[model samples]
Target: MTGQEENGATRKGPTRALVLHPDLKSERRRRAPELALAEAVSLAAALADLAVTGAEVVRLARPQPGMLFGAGKIEELKARIEADEVELVLIDGPVTPVQQRNLEREWKVKLLDRTGLILEIFADRAHTREGVLQVELAALSYQRTRLVRAWTHLERQRGGLGFVGGPGETQIEADRRAIDEEVVKIRRQLAKVVRTRELHRAARRKVPFPIVALVGYTNAGKSTLFNRMTGAEVLAKDMLFATLDPTMRGVLLPSGKKVILSDTVGFISDLPTQLVAAFRATLEEVLEADLILHVRDIAHPETEEQAADVREILESLGVEEEVPVFEVWNKIDLLTLEQRAALLVQDARTPGIHTVSALSGEGLEALLDAISTALDDRRTIETLTLGFEEGRARAWLHEQGVVKAERDGDEGHEMTVALTERQRAQLERLRQG
Candidate 1:
């Protein structure tokens, strides 16, 4: 709610964003070169939407140990900030404590890098208690490094971390220790959250519903597709990182079998290390899924590249090719007739390929059918032979499996049961007894 009056007219906010692109050649590159710039731009805009009034972009010189950008570029940016009365400068790449402090001093504005911007976004978006805890853990983990530009009234501890000087706590060492203590507290709380989630997962396993995780590049229409499929309104937006947390709901297939559909946080090339680690609990939903629906924005210029990036992330997450996958070429409505026809033909030959417009609900029935068929194929049929003496087992078979027929005999009775593998195993154990 930082605001400034504009010519005594409507009040305006104080935030000013400076979007940056890290030189790919630098050892400090934050993400893949192809996605880094575009992601940075998207994040900057999203940040501005979070109460920032004005925004601008700057290309930083390749990472130098001492300075983030070259001296010449710094001078030019400083002038702009001064003239525009900029209150904040947002860098698209990671900035070391030294770099952040130096930039703030030179530019005379609050400076934040890609990590800070993302952390800020999470801080703003997190509503649930668990979600807030995760975001706080990440923010604290990040802030433990860079702590400069203490607002005018904010105290720098007298005996704490050198970054913050609070009354009677100036020692930077003490501040670091305090921050470390808080980090431990947050971690413990998040660990509890993870355990709670694990219990929920166990409950789901007992019900034995197949899980299909919707995964793709950020802003690749994953949320849109998820809402279309599950009819949940979990924030579908055209902005990057619109959906941070993973969302799960029951999706009934055309055959009337129920499956769990989890819309997970979208993958972005060069995703921040801190974020990946902090959000591991949420992402593991993908790992446990029975199938992965890789929804892609087919019309994006970097669609293929984005797909590769998502694959890399999946690999890192241990979601290997062994898990069933279906590729959903989304946003078909955005394509021209010629391009759409070409993609339709090309994707047709690709296994598990389907086209759909999540926004417009186009071709969704086909996708659902494909999912139902995939689930059916995963179901293994087990044959069972039961003796009449085992009447209890026979009765259980009737409850759990589809019985074909019954043959009666003087000694006992036998029945053929088409049951699932688990049911068959149980029945076999019963027969042996």
Candidate 2:
């Protein structure tokens, strides 16, 4: 059988899937197993063609090396799967290649671990060229690791390292070599796309508009808020990984200051390592942001945990410490009146936090006012000394319309300029360069 056939019997309609979250006793748990299972179900729902037939948290004292579950549990699950006619089993945790192969053979169903499931979702949601390439690259990297003897499709094609290929090459080795070659090819394509993105970013920088990035956990109403703030019709569905690619729109703030608003892919707990590396470029917008709005789904039960995960991802992405961040407590409409009132009271007291319901437009005015105030360009007049050789810095200051007066001196030029903090930083960079 081909790899796809071995994965699952060919079906004409939606694939019936069973979601399982392993509640291992020995593992240090970060999230409740029930909640994790619910999330897994939601993730399965994100795929249009997947029909989740059932979901549950399966408890385990320990994992079997080859099967990942004991004989009794395996047989029980197999019976249940057969009874339910489930074609796919989605495990909400890591599963090794050997265990996956064994489980598929024992259960007579295709198996997808957490990473594989996520890759499938990404593959389905990716739209842009770069997004598609990144997902393909991540999938290839993931597939290379799971190239067992059962994946017969890999043996049909062979083109890499012509001299090394002969009767001596094993199927698994050929498959891995092909995947590696594809990875290299995709990297080259990604580099070109990244260069184009950089050029666009450079052009945006010249526009003098600060970039305000909306970042949060998946399904946290970031896209809804982006649409609300910019009046742009971006996909704002309440789905995990709904917005896979970065989108930017120009918005005139309430204070008449124009800023570029960016909506980026949402973060998730325990994001696959392959995706984290592959989608790094997609999240680079967060790094260049002059201000970040950390939108939160306040209605979610695991709101605090989700916030921590977002912060962890942000820190890992190397977001600068100096960039200002505003915590946006979104989805207030989902809260009860008493809860909303109490949240508003707390939001009023907090300096950097705002509560709003992006869907209903409640508290959006105040949020906008706060965003305007935060991005206000309060200027300061200062005397700057630039050497004659530092013409680029002087030109930049003049180009920014910050230079008020200038005079030539023996060692350099003395200039009086009104500068915002951003301009000062830009000038400093120009000098350093």
Worst 10 residues of 1 by lDDT: 157-166
Instruction: Please give the CA lDDT of all the candidate structures.
Output: 0.71, 0.83
Q: Highest lDDT: which candidate?
A: 2
Q: Runs in model 1 with CA error above 4 Å?
A: 4-14, 24-35, 48-61, 147-171, 382-433
Model 2: per-residue lDDT, tens digit, 227-331?
A: 998899998897898999899999987778788899999999999998988999999889878789999999999999999999999999988776789999999
lDDT of 1 by residue, 1-433 (tens): 2343468874554355555565645365434555566667677665433333344444544566677778888888788777866666767767888888788778866666777777766655566567778777776677666544332112422111212111222346665677688889878888888889878776665566677899998889999988888888899889877887778899899899888999877787667777777777778878777788999999988888889988988888776455778999999999999999998898778879999999999889988988998877765644445556689877765654356677876666656644443345556677778
**Candidate 2, which ten residues in sequence have the lowest lDDT sum?**
158-167
- Spell out the clash pairs found in candidate 2: none
